[model samples]
Structure formats: C-alpha cells, structure tokens
Target: MEFGEILRLSFAAIRGNKLRSLLTLLGIVIGVFSIIGVMTAVQVLQNGIESGLSNLGAHTFQIQKFPVMASQAEWLKARNRKNIDLRQAEYVASRMTHALYVGIESFDNGETVQALSGEKTNPNVTVFGENPEGISTNNWTIAEGRTITAADDRSGNRVVVLGKDVVSKVFPRGGAIGQEVKVDGVRFTVIGIFEPKGAALGGPNNNFVAIPLSTFMAYFGGNRRSLNIMIKAKGPEYYDDAVEEARFLLRTVRKVDPGKEDDFSIFSNDSMIATFNDFTKYVKLGVGFISFISLLAAGVGIMNIMLVSVTERIKEIGVRKAVGARKANILSQFLVEAIVLCQIGGVIGIFVGILAGNLAAMALELPPVFPYDWAALAVLICSIIGVIFGVYPAWKAANLDPIESLRYE
Candidate 1:
C-alpha cells in the first residue's frame, strides 16, 4: 500500500479508539510541559539581568570588603578582613595614574529622614557619603540644580543630592533644591536631584540621598569602616592595566604578604554576570533531569498502549497481510500512529508551557519570553520516543503469520 493509505488507516484506528489515544497522550503532555515551563521562566530572568544589571556602563569595577556573591565560609573569611577605609581609598586614587576617575563612597542604610517644612514627614531613607568624583564614576546625571563640587568636599558642607523618590516625598512643593532635609536628626541642604535609574537586583536605585564625604564623616562619623571604591578606566583598551595597577596598589597599601591571598575583593560588572549565568546553568541541568524522568515514564506508557493495539487488531493485521500488504508497510503504519500521538501531545504542551511561564515571569516583574529552541527540541524528542517505544509492537504485528492470526481470532 502507499504511505498515504497507511497513514489514513492509522488515523482511522486512532479515531476508533478515541479514549485510549487521549489517555496515551496525557503522559507525553505532562513530560514536555514540566521541562518547557521551567526553561522559559529561567530564560526570562536571565534576559532581565543582562539588560538591567549586567554591565555598569563599560570598563568600570568596584573594590569592596566582600564579594558580590559568596558562600558562608568565604563570608566569614571576608568578615575577618580589615574594612576598605576612606583613607585607603584616597591613597589608591592618588597612586592610580591610568584611571580617569576614582570615587569612594560609604553607605548607612535604614536611616530616618524628615523634611522639616511643616508637619509632613517621610521616613526610612538610605544615605551615601561620596566625594566629587562619585558623580562621574556612578554615571549619575543631575536632573536639577548642581552636583556636589570639590569645594563642598573640602569645606565639609552640609549639602545633599536627592534621588527621585526622596525628592518627590520630601520636597512635595516642586522646589527641592535649596531646601533642608533632616537626615538622622542632622539637617542638610539639597543641592541637586538625580535622574531616575529604575530598579536593580540590590533594590530600588532611586531611593537614596547623596552627600559630601566630609559632611557625612562629620555628622555620621568617620570611625565607621567599610568603604566602597569605584574606578573607571581611562578607556576600554586600558581596562585590564587599570585593574592590575589598582590591585597592586591596594595590596601594597594593605601590606599583604606576596605569597598570601589578598584580603580584598575586586570585581567588574562582567564578573557578576558570569556568576549569575553559572548559577542558572545548574538550574537548567536540574530541570532537564526532572523532564527526563517524566519522559521515560511517558515512553513506557506509549509502549504498553501500542502492544494492546496490536492484540486488538490481530484479525485485521491477518487480512492486510493476506491481501498483499508488506511487513514493512504494517510496521510503518503502527510507527506513524505512535509518532502522530506524541506530536499532538508535544504541541499542546508547548502552548501551555509558554502561557504558564509568561504568567510566572509577569508575577516576578520580568519580561515575557518564548523558548523556540526548546519547543523544537521537544517535538524532535517526542518523535524519537515514539520510535523507541513503538518498535516492539510494530515488529510483533508484522511477524505474525496470517494463517495463525486468522485461526486465533
């Protein structure tokens, strides 16, 4: 018989056993759905991190007391290390000739801030103590008024730059500049407003106040350790040299033994991104393992159903063989039926997975994603599963003697 005739006969058999066909499809559907859903969600989060938090412009890195992502053992070791103080930051800045800008900042979180105009008050604001070069290093654009100047740092002036969130709440009257806001009971004049930078992996970027390092040290006290140094290379070509020089200078300043590991951590935006990708790579592997287990179960189900199908159509198989239907034709018919069933399940699973995954992404505030490559792979895997499971049943149907099959039923 022709291939088209065999395919039509396979469809007729499936339609004749509608309930059984649907039951067989259920296993494959669930297997594909489990894997595709997880992959789609992970892809969406990766895309978001790459676009929003990955690269801090270009050729920029930070020197901090602790690594961005560390284990408990590493954290304990880092905690024992001496803090990156402002004095050390200044020393490194002065020695680094290849750097275009070097800025130092210290942060105090969960401080209460109140604008003392009338009775209106807002609380819980983050405060940053930074030098003049911090504006350029952080890539912050002044939305209104002027940025902190070198004179402000030298004189220890009580001037501040308000972030978008702080400006809206503290200075609701439209004019935030020249106004005084009390930060932890210390009053400081607002010198500028920063442009909105949106949310980051850490938290909201536009929800803090920036002040001169000298004034912050005086009010918040300079005794606190833990300073973050931001450095921007002169150009992309000099990025490696700048980082090497910074590391050498810092090690020298900290008086580290040449053989011993440096106590400080230095990392760029690219390093952070690579760390995140490494973490997600494990997640993908885990998901794949789980999907494999499900698919294995589904393959067993397909085999069982195909075996029963051969038994039920024993007399029909005998008639086909007696009427000149070749064994290869008989095998091909059964195989096509199994493949068609799996493809049906795969298509449904892909659709459901995409919808479910996008919904989860929306809940997490990430953009929607469609995993096309995974979908194509799903279809291909389903076809392979069908062949593996259908082979035994198809062979059994093809090898049965026509006279014996006719006599049995």
Candidate 2:
C-alpha cells in the first residue's frame, strides 16, 4: 500500500477509537505544556531583567558600601566598614582625570513629605541627597522646571526635585515648581520634576524626592550614613582607566592597608546583568528537570496505549500479513499512528502553554513573549517520544505469525 493509504488507515483507526486516543493524547499534551509554559515565562522575565533593570548608562558604574550580590558573611563584614562620605566622593571627583562625571548620593529613610499647602501628603517617600552631577550620572531627565544646580549644592539651598509619582500625589493641582514642600519637617522649594521611569527590580524608580547633598547632610546628619558615588567615563574606551583611578583615590582617601581588601564595592551595568543571568540559570535547570519528568511519564503512557492497540487489532494485522503486507509496512503504519497522536497533542500543548505563559507575564507587568525555539523543541521532543515508545509495540505486531493471530481471535 502507498504511504498515503497507510496514513488514511491510521487516521481511520484513531477515529474509530476516539475516546481512547484522546485519553492517550492527554498525557503528551500535559507533558509538552509543562515544558513550554515554564520556558516561555522564564524567557519573558529574563528579557525584562536585561532591558529594564540594567538602567545604568554606558560606561557608568557606582561605588557603594555594600556589594550588589553578597553572602551573609560579606554583608556582615561590609556593615562594619566605614560609610563612603560626601567628602571622599568630592575628593575622587576632583582628582580623577579620566572621569567625565561624578555624582554623590545619600538616602534619608522613613521620611514623610507634605506640601506646605496642606492639600496632600505621602506617608513614606524616599528622599535622596545628591550633587548637581547626579542628574547626568544617573541618566535622569528633567521633565519640568530646572534640575539641581552647582549653586544649589554649593550654597546648601533647600531645593528639591520631585519624581513623577511624588508630583502627582503632592501637587495634584499642578504648578509644582517653586512650591514649598516639607521633608521630615524641613521646608524645601521644588525646583524640578523628573520624567516617569516606571518600576524596576529595585522597585518604583520614580517615587522619590531629590535634594542637594549639602542640604541633606545639614539636615539629616551625614555621619554614619553611607554615600553612593556614581561615576561615568568620558567614553567606553576610558571606562577601565576611570574605574582604576576612582578606586585608587577612594582607597587612598579611606587609608586602606596595602594587603587588605578595599572596603567599598564597585559594580557596573554589565556586572549586574551577569549576576542576574547566573541566578536565572539555576531556575531554568530546575524547570527543565520537572518538564523532562512529565515528558517521561507521557512517553510511558504512549507505550502502554500502543501495546493495547496492537492487541485490539490482532485480527486486522493477521489479514494484512496474509494479503502480502511486509513486516516493515506493518511496523511503519503503527509507528506513524503513534507519531500522529503525539503531534496532535504537541500542537495543542504549544498553544495552551503560550497562552498560559503570556498570562503570567501580564500579571507580572512584563511584555508578552513568544518562545518560537521552545515551541519547535516541544514538537521535536514529542516526535522522539512517539518513536521511542511506539517501536516496541510496532515490532511485536509485525513479528506475530499470521496463522496464530488469526486463530487467536
């Protein structure tokens, strides 16, 4: 018989036993779904991390008291180290010849801010004390009004820049510029408003108020509080030199011993991205293991169902063999049927998995992604499973003697 005729026969047999075929296909569907769904979700999250979380501009890095990824022991050691201060930041900024910009920043935690107008208030607002260069180093753009200037930091002026969220909340009536707002009881005039930055891995990026470093130190007491130093190189070519210069300056200013490790941590956008990828690698491995187990179970189910199918069609196999059907032909026909069943299941699973994965992405506020490679892999795995499981049953049917098969039924 032609290949087309054999395929038609296989479809006829499946259609004849609709319920049984469906039950067998369910296992394969679930198996494929598990793998594809997990992979899709992982890809989407990874994409978000690479694009959204790595916000540091080109050739830029930050020096802080703590490491971005640290063990408990490292954290404890870092906690005991002296805080990076505004004076040290300024020294490094003034001395580093290869640097294009240096920004000094400190945070005042647990602060409540309210407009003097008394119309609105935020119970918990982050307050940042930063120098004038912070705007460029942090890659923030001013949406309305002017940013903190050299005059503001030098004169210790009580001026502030509002994040989009803070602006919307405290200045609902608009005209936030030149308005006075109380930060933890100290009054500050709004000089600028920042553009919306949305949320990142570290949380809402635009829900804070920025003030001059000098003013923050005056009011919040800079002692014992760690300052973050942001530095940007003139270009990518000078990034290494800039980092080395800043490190040397910081170590010298802090009076670190020659043999001992530096107390500060310096990290760039590339390091942050590498760390994130390393963490997600393990997540992918765990998910892949689970999906593999499911597929293995589905393969077993296919083998069991194919064996039953061979038994049920024993008389039909005998008649075909008696009519000059070769053992190879019989084997191929049964194999094709098994593969077709798995393919059907694979298609359904891919569709469901993509849908479920995108739904999860939506819940997390991540962009939807279609994992085409994973979908193709799912289909390929399904085909492989079908062949591995189908071979045994197909061989058994082909090797059976026509006379015995005919006599049995």
TM-score of each: 0.86, 0.87
Tell me the tens digit of each residue's lDDT in model 2 across 1-409: 7989888988998898899999898988898888788888888777776666545678999999999887899999899889887788889989988888898888876677789878555567788888988878877889999999999999999999998888888888899999999988899999999988746654546778899988999998876699999999999999999999999999999999898899999999888778877887888788778877888888888889989999998998999899898999999989988888888889999989999888878887878899999999999999998899899999999998999988776
lDDT of 1 at 323: 89
- How far does residue 397 in candidate 2 sit from its true spot (Å)? 3.9
Look at candidate 2 and tell me the lDDT of residue 409.
Answer: 68
How many pairs collide in each candidate, listed in order? 0, 0
**TM-score, cand. 2 vs. native:** 0.87
Scored by CA lDDT, what does every candidate get? 0.85, 0.87
- Top lDDT: which candidate number? 2
Model 2, residue 71: what's the lDDT? 84
Q: Ten-residue segment with the worst summed lDDT in candidate 1?
A: 117-126
lDDT of 2: 0.87
